[model samples]
Target: GIQVEQSPPDLILQEGANSTLRCNFSDSVNNLQWFHQNPWGQLINLFYIPSGTKQNGRLSATTVATERYSLLYISSSQTTDSGVYFCAVGGATGTYKYIFGTGTRLKVLA
Candidate 1:
């Protein structure tokens, strides 16, 4: 089994401002994914980086499996980006389970 924790807990930003979110896990994970849940409850997969880094438009992610942590970066934040960002981790253990972090709530104002 794995346990996940997210920092800051919440965030508020003005439009165009950038921010970084972090996720920490207690156990080794075979798969890691970052998701953004929009205001309307639509879940968007932002990244699936088990290691290294990845970028898509104004969003990017980096994972350090060895250190048991992951990072999500948002650049040029927009009002539409306001939502709950989650980090879900899947363990390699026999049970094959996925543990999710509490989530980071982001608010971007105009």
Candidate 2:
């Protein structure tokens, strides 16, 4: 079994600000995914960063399996970025189900 933890349970960002969210895992993971759970509770997949870094628009993610941690970077924060960011990890021998971290909730004030 794997354990996940997220830092900064809550965040407040003014429009145009930047922030970094972190996730730490207890064990090695074969799969790592970043998700943004909108205010409506819909989960939007941000990235599947098993390794390296990736960016899409104002959002980016990086995962270091050897260190057992991942990071989500949000730049130029907007009202749309207001939501809960979650990091999910899947390991071998498991059901392939993702184990999510507590999440970092962001509030972007317009």
- In the order shown, what is each candidate's alpha-carbon RMSD? 0.8, 1.1
TM-score of 2: 0.95
Model 2's number of clashes is: 0
Query: lDDT tens digits, residues 10-88, model 2?
Result: 9999999999999999988889999999999999999999889999999999998899999999999999999999999
lDDT of 1 by residue, 1-110 (tens): 58899976999999999999999999888899999999999999999998999999999999999999999999999999999999999986756777899999999999
TM-score of each prediction: 0.96, 0.95
- Can you give the lDDT of residue 27 in candidate 2? 86
lDDT of 2: 0.92
Q: Please give the range of 10 consecutive residues that has the lowest summed lDDT in model 2.
A: 91-100
The local distance difference test score of each candidate is 0.93, 0.92
Clashing pairs in 2: none
